[model samples]
Target chain A: MTTNILLITLVVLAIIALNTQKLRRAVVYLGVFSLISSFLYLLYGAPDVAIAEAVIGTTITTVLYLVALKKYQVFTIYFCSDPNDPNRRNLTNNSPFINNLESFLIKQEMEPQIIYSEKPLKTILTQDKFDLAICQTNQKTLIYGSVDDYQLDALEDYLLTNHGDLNIHLIRYTEGDDNEA
Target chain B: MTDNSEIITRMTGLLYPFILLFGFYIIINGHASPGGGFQGGAVLAAVFITRYLVDPNRCIQLKTLKTAEKILFVCIILYPTFFLFSTSASHTELMNLIYLIAMNFLIGLKVCSGFTIIFFRFVFYEGGIL
Candidate 1:
């Protein structure tokens, strides 16, 4: 009777782990699954295998999944250029600086989503959520980023050193500040 | 990762020595008792895992662990083969017991190091250091 219960619990945990949308929650479920299976192993008289399963399955696998999740984090950068600025026409087409930035973000293991917006910078900054926003004018490129983003520091250094010829202004947005630059 | 609560930290600190002693006891008496090398090694690994959970920023070098794992692997493989080839038909029980004990100790070391290495790698990579 107890064995049957454990088997049913194991099946349920496995299904939940597979079906869960969040990877972290799935990992936790898998941990519980492993723990139950290891107990089952002990009941079945395979203590050696049970020990290995309990150790490798519960602890090691969960940590590995979390690390993998961390390493593959995608950084979304929103590109919102002024639609009325006639001088900024063809800015999205064949822009070398934008291409370079995209490549740099890719190299850093981040997926840069460049959104070409006709909306004003104020609306994009205030209404829309984004990790970064790039506004292009005739004279300069305005890069808006969150102060809390750790990757922005490295990106700032990269932009200053590599694209020194371009007139670029970096504006940081902190919490509770809604001032339009 | 966040540090464990002060109560958990204090409790783990208080209980760590007992756990270590129990794990060693299991390893040493593996041939005669229910627990063996893998079980003991796993228990020992849990101690390290508990420590890491309390303090995520603690530095653990993986190179030494990898080296120790490799050494244990060699011992586990070679010693069993050597014993198998060299032992005669007489006094096989005594030889078997010794073999089991030696293999248990080696396996305990290997499992301990292997799990610890995986843990340290996960922590380091998660911290964006690797």
Candidate 2:
């Protein structure tokens, strides 16, 4: 009876974990589900698999979460045209930030036109629409087309939070350099 | 993190060993029924894991895991190899059982050590086997 309850609980929690959009919550619930499943495996007398599930499902996953979390502080944002102010919610942090907003907009589904630039020494930001021009560098200035300001701001904030983009050369990937503004 | 019920927490702490034994029992009786070495060993490891959870610093003893793992690996391989060479007809029931146990033990050791090593190397990174 208790075993059945465990199974049912695991199944429900697993469903919730899979469907949840929150990354941290998903990881936490997934860890619990894995640990419970390991318990069930013990009840059913499958030790080898139980061990693997326990380690991989629980410990490794928790580690993955911690490591990834250390790398980022995820923020949500979306792109839309609003010329007056592109980068909204300027997170008051002095650290350099990597702008992921433009790329988010130009994701595989967006099919953005990539433009290039001629000047190579320094880098700057310009905009076509309400989308913010996230200046990225990797030994060269990369202008990844136009991204919605909302998305760009979130990306920059994330970079700032992680303390990245200092003393690192920014590299840009887009269509061509002619559109450098 | 103690739970709501002091009795339950105390009981669980006390009963953890038995829970481990239960797993071990399943393992030892694996061949007789539907289980084998891997199952049994995992149960043993579970004891350590449980201990660790209950007291993070106290889960697996690094020295014990290393020494036992080395000895277990040697035995699993040596037993199987000896059987393969010496026994003209290892297809016999006794031989089959022995071989199964050996293989099961090896599987358990590998799984436990491998997971621990990976976790220690990539995740923990401070202590454990460097």
My TM-score estimates for the predictions, one after another, are 0.61, 0.44
Task: Provide backbone clash counts, one per model.
Answer: 0, 18
Q: For candidate 2, lDDT tens digit of each residue in B1-130?
A: 2223556457669988786677566665666665455545554555544443354444345566667667777776687777778967547877687777657657666556644554444434542221
Interface RMSD of each: 3.7, 10.0
Q: What TM-score, to 2 decimals, does candidate 2 have?
A: 0.44
Residues A1-181, model 2: lDDT tens digits: 9899998998899899888856677889989999999899989988667766775578656655654443333221212212333342342122123234335434412223223223321342332321223333333223233332224344444445554434322223342223111
Report the CAPRI category for model 1.
incorrect
Candidate 1 local lDDT, residue B41: 91
True contacts kept of each: 0.37, 0.07
Q: What is the TM-score of chain B in candidate 1?
A: 0.86
How does each model score on lDDT? Answer: 0.79, 0.52
Alpha-carbon runs more than 4 Å astray in model 1? A70-74, A78-181, B81-89, B125-130
